[model samples]
Target: MNLFLDSFWRSVAYCLRPRVIALSFLPLVLMVALALGLGYYFWEGALDWVRGALESSSMVNNVWTWLQSAGAGSLKMVLAPLIVIFAVTPVIVVLSLLMVAILMTPALTLLVAERRFPQLERKRGGSMLMSLMWSLGSTGLALIAIVISVPLWLVPPLILVLPPLIWGWLTYRVMAFDALAEHASVEERREIFRRHRGWLLGIGVFCGYLGAAPSLIWASGALFAAAFVILVPLAIWIYTLVFALSSLWFAHYCLAALQALRTEKELAATTALAAALAPSQTTIDVQALPLPDDTTSDARPQS
Candidate 1:
């Protein structure tokens, strides 16, 4: 836990290198577009649902006066989406931070995999355009999950799990992180995930939960929503840096513990570990695993 936090700040220190710092805000920029565009489209549906739900329930009914006054009803219509974003602000913030963190990951992970590996090259492949596309791609996938799990909100659990992992994986792509990794594609990453599946997911779930914390209050008032817009970019930068550094540290720890080896070689890595350390370091220790995933669910209820 301490190591993750420490590594996160340290990664931030490195990411602020004159070059990467310029592009660090890329994810947040794309996210704003995603939030505005996605938010606009979803607001109508969310409002209808809220209105329908309010008609039958005593809970939201008390606010009917507030709901219909002037453009109040219209405002209420966007409330659900606004609230969702508001409650999940922390997660969103972390997600933004994840962008910057991902940018730094290639170099950071390189250092982890190979001692004194040179700093990763900062080439622009996944641009603001790419992240927007990433958001669109991921949002489409998440929307599908939402549809399949609707009414019962089974999707919340998945949301609690998926976002951070996706962010991490996206970092994998943009940061060229897997230069040291054995797996390349989603298939390979999944395979690597499977080999050390338990811990890998544990890390993802843990980070996602924490990442999703801001969303806990996402359903709150206008003030909170305003606060969220202000806080999101910075929060995300911090969140990504912290989560990525922590995750990479955890990954390194897992590699040390799990020893998920390929069939061909008993000694998996190249000159990675010292010859002296290699003999004693071969065995992985699971007991040293870090924290659990965050919240059980967002404020959304099961139907």
Candidate 2:
């Protein structure tokens, strides 16, 4: 909890840094703004196109006939391409953003880590792919649970535990691992998550399932698809923000874990130097840390 809270703040501070913030989020905010622009353009087009199709068709002659004859499957057949276009485009945009976010994380850690453990990355831990996979896969599961539970409005709230817990574990790894895995890449991270397919699925089944929302994000988590108007457009933006910040928070944990696992000399050196290099105690965080998982490790960094 302590670790996550710090990591969360670190991400915000790192993002807002006079120099780093300008360097990092300038690209990010611009990209987001551009993507949003493109998204709104296309989304409106898709809506217009769908409405035009429905209006042109005799489907609405009688709502029941339209429903019984042209059911969702039938409508999907007609709108499939549009659905694919609208759906896949946003996904691509979000993935692009994640790529950027992952790249930005190391920059935030570089200054602090260098002043503390100059020889970072000699420590033990999963490979880059392995570590990133842990975080990505966990988040992915959270998404899946949310997607799968769209029909069960009454049950979604009960499935909300998965994301937070899985996310917390991933946060611990990200905060702790980066100090040891400087050479890690985004591709490696994705592959690692792929390698641990079962764990990711298990996370969803066990905990991520709790994150399932009967309602999509923008629609106020509404239980029914009837709320599509509010959910569709805004979900992309809202979910992206939540997921991105959450991923950064997790990354902070693994990065911190990387530092924490160092030796006592490293710890002493860090304790002293951290005051100068560190973002203040309030700046450093442990809330994002995993619940002292024996499933992981706790050795401090070496000087």
Candidate 3:
């Protein structure tokens, strides 16, 4: 618990640093540009397709008719845009996470290491290719979980719970691995995961909830289209900052854990060596030896 809170506060403090703050914008700029470019190309077509799909559905038409009778017909205008926004929101989130992992995590890890754990060895347990593959694989599973759990999300409470849980699991997997990739060997990394899985996941889930905050801006964008162009970059920037904080949290936590693990193993090794040499260091009783020299000398003189 101390470790968890310690790392969390450290990460929060680090986020305030000029260097860390600047590093966060790198992903933000790239994501914002990519988001704008995609929005330019596909925004209209996606809205149209969603509107057409809604129009083609008899059930949706019935709901629209009922809504009209209920004097809530204005909802019909926003529904397509809302659908498009929701659909694209997940992609934005995943991309934001990946961007942090790819662009910001290494630097953040190094920043933490250099400042706090300067003596920690770099085992280079995970390479860029391995980290990429691990991230992609975890992301694939997370997307699958999201799709499978979408129905459950209709439950009001589950909606809040499930998405964060998925994002949290993904964050834990990706952030923790990247944080330790350069400093911990494969064995040490796995050991830390084994020992601290619960706390790490908690950090990820907490960050996941933090990541969800930007969705409010997304929602606002959908409702107020005029502000979308501005809000989207804002939301993307928030996502980048949130994930950057997450990367720092994991880096601090995992590196500290690695240092502790090595210290523990070294202590145990020293203890074991001392135990092995202990008997040899015991005092011997020279007086307890049999005295055969006098008898032998007397016998030789008599002969």
Candidate 4:
């Protein structure tokens, strides 16, 4: 609990740093450009496809006709675009997180190490290639979980529980590994993971819930079509900021945990060495104590 709260406040403070704020924009810009490029080329085609799909469903078409007759035809105009946005929101989120993990995490970890754990040794437990592969694998699994859980989403309680859990697992897996990659050896990293897995996943799940806040903004973007150009970037920026905070949180917690691990090991070693020497020192003390010399005991012998 102390570790969790310590890292949490530290992360919140770090997010306010000028460097951190500047770094966040990189992902936002990349996502915005990607969004714009795709919108320019495929926007119409995607909307048409969604509309066609909606139209082909007799039940939906009947509902649409009723809505039109009820003088709510304006909803039809936004529905297709809204569907497209909803369809793409998950992709955007996954991409934004990946971008932050790839670009921001290492730098944030370095920053935390420099400021807080400067003496922490760099053991390079994880390499760039390995980190990338791990992230991709985790992401694949999370997506699969999302797909497999779609039916379960129809259940009211499960809908609230499952996706965040999957995302939380992914967030913990990726962010914690990247945070400790440089300074902790593989064994040390594994030990830290084994010990702090619950706290780390708590942080991830909390951040996962935070990550959902942007979807509300995304919904607003769909509702107010005129503001979507602005809202899309805003939503992406929020995602970037949330991921950035998550990275910082992981960095602070993992590095601190690693430092504590080293300190504990060092203390244990010192204690072991002291114990090993105590017996020899006691023997020396016993030997150094002068034995009763024969000459000194002459009076006792005569007695």
Best by lDDT: 3
Candidate 4 lDDT, 1-303, residue by residue in tens: 998999999999999999999999988889999999998999899989999999899998898889989999779888888879877877888898899999899999999999999888899989999999999999998888888888898799986788778778989999999999999999999999999999999999998888888888888988887998999999999999999999999999999999999999999999999999999999999999977878766756443
lDDT of 3 by residue, 1-303 (tens): 999999989999999999988988898899889999999999999999999999999999999999999999999999898888888888899999999999999999999999999998899999999999999999999999999999998899999999999999999999999999998999999999999999999999999999999999998998998999999999999999999999999999999999999999999999999998776665344555666788667775444
Model 1 segments more than 4 A misplaced: 1-23, 36-150, 153-194, 216-221, 225-228, 250-303
lDDT of 2 by residue, 186-241 (tens): 54444444544343333223322222231234223223446544454454443334
- Best first by TM-score, ranked: 3, 4, 1, 2
Highest TM-score against the true fold, candidate: 3
- Give a tens-digit lDDT track for model 1, residues 1-303: 543354445544555555444444565577666665755687567657765775787666667666676557666555556655543453455446445444544445555555422232223333445445654555455445444544443467755445555544433333322332432333434455465455444455555555555444344433365765555455555455445544455445433332333332346444445676765665444445654655644455769
Q: How close is candidate 1 to the true structure, as a TM-score?
A: 0.46
Worst 10 residues of 4 by lDDT: 294-303
- Global lDDT for candidate 3? 0.93
Clashes of each: 23, 46, 0, 0
Assess every candidate by TM-score: 0.46, 0.42, 0.92, 0.92
How does candidate 3 fare on TM-score? 0.92
Q: Which window of ten consecutive residues has the lowest lDDT sum in model 3?
A: 280-289
Q: Please give me the total number of clashing residue pairs in predicted model 3.
A: 0
Kindly report which residue stretches of model 2 are placed more than 4 angstroms away from their true locations once superposed: 1-15, 26-30, 33-37, 49-97, 119-143, 153-180, 183-252, 264-303
